[model samples]
Each structure stands twice: as C-alpha cells, then as structure tokens.
Target: MTPLHRVGSALAIAVALSLVTACTAPAPTPSPTPTIDDSAANTPPPTPAESVAPAGGSDPTCETIIPAATVEDFESLGWSAEQDDFRVGATIIDGGLQCVWADHAGPATDHVQIFGWAPIEQDAAYDAQDNLVGEGWVREDQPDGVYITENPETTISTDENGYGMTYLFGDGWVKVADTKQGLLLVVWGD
Candidate 1:
C-alpha cells in the first residue's frame, strides 16, 4: 500500500482497537446500601402508639395542641397572629378543626396554620413530610417522634412568575407533632 494508505489503515486499526477495548470494559460496581425489609422476615410494619382525642366533639387547633401560655410565649418571641380563622372539618382528622392565622407580626412575617389528626391519620403523618402529604416540602424527623419540614422557605404569592400559594411553608419552619389525643399541632414560623 502507498504510505498515505498505510497511515490511513493504521489509524483505522487504532480506532477499532479503542472501540473494542471500550466495549469489553467492565461496568463500575454499585455500592450496596443497607435496607430494612420487614416483609422478607414476615414481620409487619410497626404501628405507632394509638392517639386518642379529647372528650366531646371539640376540634384541636394550634391553641389546643399548644398551651395558651406557650402561644403567649411564642408571641413574646415576635411571633404574632393578628387574624386567625378556625374551622371544624376533616382536613386533618375526622371532626377535627384546622386553624389558619395570617399577617403575623415578626421578623419572618410568616403565616401559620394548625391541624389535628386522629389515630387513623397516623400513617398519613408518618408518611408525610408536611402536615399535609405531597406538597413538595421535605420531611425531617425530630427526637420526639415529630416530623417537620426541612427549611421550609416557601412564600405565598399571587404572581404566576413567583412561587405561589402551594409553597405554603413560608420563609421559616413548619412543625407537626402528634398529641396523644389524635391531635397534630402545626406551626409556621422561625
């Protein structure tokens, strides 16, 4: 072959060798992660302590779950709710009321809402990151069996270009705690 043809042939052979080497290369092994599978062991999922509600048809609110004294203390710490709306409904629990407070007076200026859940809703809370499940907020665990949102820096806005109301956590934190009485207390603030 002419020198040019020889050089071209050599390049072709080199390319072919590289392609063959790549095709034969072993794939990287994935590191195994520890996982718990109760089904495999024939063990059922552990159930949480049964939560009971207070006597009567009363609905739990933030004020109910959190003591009045505690609410005052929080207000002293710059968390103030000017107007609050409370409604008895099944938003969190059967016959439970949900409360929403708006235009808070504080450095964060956040809106607050509270919810109470029954034992039936225990699984929902455990599975949820927020007071309500599947709202885009991330769930974090506390030492006291409480599930709260991780850095819920959401803002409520009407502007479509801006973050809308669905991002309701606000520019602080949203906390949910199961009160043994089937009550889930939620607070939005710093």
Candidate 2:
C-alpha cells in the first residue's frame, strides 16, 4: 500500500481498538458499607431541658395508690427522694400496673398526657405485698379517699370567690388548683 493508505489504515485500526476497549470494559463494583464506630453506636441520647409524660392505659384511682387519704399516704410515692426525672414517683408511671406515659403530652399550655395504671415493682420476697394499694394517679374526681397534701404539682380547686369546690371523683381530670383557697385552709375541703 502507499504511505497515505498506510496512515488511513492505522487511524481506522486505532478507532476500532478504542471502540472495542469501551464495549468490553468491566462494570464498576459497588462500594462496601462503611463500618460504624463503637463510640457513636454506644452513646446515649442527650436529654432536653424538660420533658413530660402523659397518662394512658388502665383506670387510675386513689385507693389503688394511697391506702388512706392521710398525709402518710403521700409518702408511699417516694417523691422526696432525689434523682432524675424518672424517680419512683417523680412522674409516677408503671407499665406493669397498666400505667403508661407519653413524653410529649402537648403544647406547654395544654395538659394532655398519657395516663395508665402504674405497676407495682415485682419482688419475690414481697409475695403478697401492696395488693391493697396502687399507683398515685390523677383522675377527674375524689379517688375513693382524701387527697394527699404532698407533691408540689398537686393543686387544690376553687370557684370564682377562690373558695374550695367539691371534687366529684371520676370527673375525668379534676381540680388542678391555681388560686389560693382561703390561705390553703379550704384546699381539699368540700
């Protein structure tokens, strides 16, 4: 062949070689999953400034929680003890007794909650223990007994005159007192 024909053949061969190389190239493999670091995997979630759990599940009553309405009844909750937000009676929730809590009850204004029967912790020793008493729950009425005068969250009810009003236990969600009932004398009174 002439020199020009030789150059043309070389160019054609180069193009054909490139096309063949591209068509037969192997496909790319997928990247492996990245391994998770131990520290990050084991780290606990940070708690917020404040959190609230609502009430739900079983019916909550006073007799089940506090045997009597006397001041002593309040102590059973162990509220005075110090601890985090989840102390025994801080929020007073128990699943075993049929009680449950909803962390996000609602907006700060609304007191929506998850209320249920608070369960009594099981103990092999106390086989027949505390069946008479139950969880300190908030129902809309007089919970079969007098209201204990503990728990800063506990409120006494009042009318326009700021006088105490009667609590008909079972009202659904009763008497969250805000005003002073004649200097606390009438708080929990009829």
Clashes of each: 1, 22
Report the alpha-carbon TM-score of model 2 versus the true structure.
0.20
| Per-residue lDDT of 179 in model 2 | 25
Each candidate's lDDT (Cα)? 0.38, 0.28
Give one digit per residue, the lDDT tens place, for model 2 in 115-152.
12223333411221122113333222233322322222
lDDT minimum window of 10 residues, candidate 2? 78-87
Output the number of the lDDT-best candidate. Answer: 1
**Which model scores highest in TM-score?**
1
Tens-digit lDDT track of model 1 for 1-190: 9999999999999999999999999999996532212121132312332223345855555565443544565455445433233211124334333344333543343334333223334444444334444555443334444443322356342222232222112122223321111122232121
* Every candidate's CA RMSD: 17.0, 22.4
Which stretches of candidate 2 lie above 4 Å from their native place? 34-190
Query: Which runs of model 1 end up more than 4 angstroms from their true locations?
Result: 1-63, 70-92, 102-120, 126-135, 150-190
